[model samples]
Target: MFKRLAKCIAFANIKGGTGKTTTCINIAGYLAKSGNKVLVVDFDPQANATSGLGIDGTTIEYSMYDAFLNQCQGYDGIPITKIVLETSVENIHLVPSSLNLGVASMLLQGTRDKTGILKRIIEPVKSFYDYILIDVPSDTGLFMLNSLRAAEQIVIPLDPSIFSLEALEYLKTYCRDIEEMSDHVINQITVVLNRAIISNSTQNSSGKPSPSEEIESRLKELPDPVFVVPQSLLIYRSQQEGLPISHYATNTGKIGKAYEAIATHLSGNSNVVTIPEREAEYAS
Candidate 1:
């Protein structure tokens, strides 16, 4: 069962370009729009989530690096509250990432508790929000390990591609290893199928099963509930405009509604919302 405090979820996939940052931004946005206090930690060195939310990571005074170093040294180098910045989206905040975060990970490797540093950094401030989403990088290094350690739940954004399907298996194995290592059970794991093409025909031009069909079949075999976000040009446009799909487009639209459904699920409203059935059919 999830703790009564803020729910910390990490959007993690060891494959890049699977829309991890995009998922983090939109879900946090919609959740905040729904009147929940949300904080997005741009844990990825790429800082895409920071930039996607209309914040210039380069200009941020204090990034995750400061917080990590502070925790490692046991000195109040900088509080996470100071590092957090408000976004244009009301009720949403961010701890912007920096290029220095890559260097910090290297430095963290020498620390006694590298994997637990992020958890330490987050412990102080997690209770301040309703949801805290960490956008993790696409690597299995100490940085990714720290992210996994800090988060209570995982949200994996997967593209409907053959490579993504394989990556999902690898991620599951990785999570099992983490659970054994840390003795912390990740209570919930939700997979979102992004950039999916919905069609009545199961097969595509090559006559093999379409990506969505294959993904759905594979996901059903697992215990996790999967939600599908259809392929749409609105996503790109929203990114370009520095706004979330829920903000740039109407929440009732295909793309916006898909993310809204995800937000509802993440907000512990699973009893109030049927995510897999409603989103899958909407995508179709």
Candidate 2:
């Protein structure tokens, strides 16, 4: 029920080190490799997504900080398009982030229609790409809300942990709040269960389930389908080298294929929200 804005996806979870930024970067890379034009909007103040793609944040001339300040705060600053830069991955581009990004959230305080600022900034460039992937902070703050407001789909990159399970429950409620605030429902939600270890099927003497078994059992209750990403050291190696898993692993190994499977799901209609009027508009 989201308005026909753009193919925006917000990768969110208010939990740090859960592979959210990594998932967003690699998925954007794979989607681009598949011949679709992709733009990565690193809305996270930490700028992890920007550096993860081999783009140095310190050397960037323009960043998301400028876009929010200019577009939202009524200053005559550069357009969002001016901030978009070509990334190391082909067919993929980026609106890089900077350390100053956190300041935008504070500056926009008390402004009218603040949550919709990102939506309006992105609305002008909808036709330029097949998808726009936004990586927001791991906190339920103004930045997170703004990105979620602009997204049509939500991708939760969850690590298998008790704390992560609690975060997912909180995220479900947060998404509903976003729908109410944005005046449209988030059409699709997909969960990527990162770093999954499925070998622990045996139970203890007391019959208590293994951690993996318990997590899987809990995951089954969620309405959305879950994709499992196994625990791999190559993931860390790829990140250290500032490369996407597909590029580093050449889409051959287990970890690489797992992410590729996720890329496959995201490439299909099942991962994207169907908006009738938008399709009609595109048809014309």
Report, for all candidates in order, the number of backbone clashes.
Answer: 0, 0
Global lDDT of model 2: 0.78
Pick the TM-score winner: 1
lDDT of 2 at 194: 79
Worst 10 residues of 2 by lDDT: 273-282
Q: What are the root-mean-square deviations of the candidates from the true structure over C-alphas?
A: 3.2, 7.7
- Candidate 2 error regions (>4 Å): 1-6, 200-209, 269-284
How do the residues 1-284 of candidate 1 rate in per-residue lDDT, one tens digit apiece? Answer: 56436889999999999989999998987898888888899997788988899997667899987887787654356879889999888888999988777877555434686678888888878778888899999987787787788888899999987888888889888888889998777878888888887655544556676767677667767677678777888878888887787777764377787788788887776643334576545756
Instruction: Give Cα-based local distance difference scores for all models.
Output: 0.81, 0.78
Candidate 1 accuracy as lDDT:
0.81
RMSD (Cα, Å) of model 1 = 3.2
* Candidate 1 clashing pairs, residues 3+ apart or interchain: none
| Structural similarity to truth (TM-score) of each candidate | 0.89, 0.87
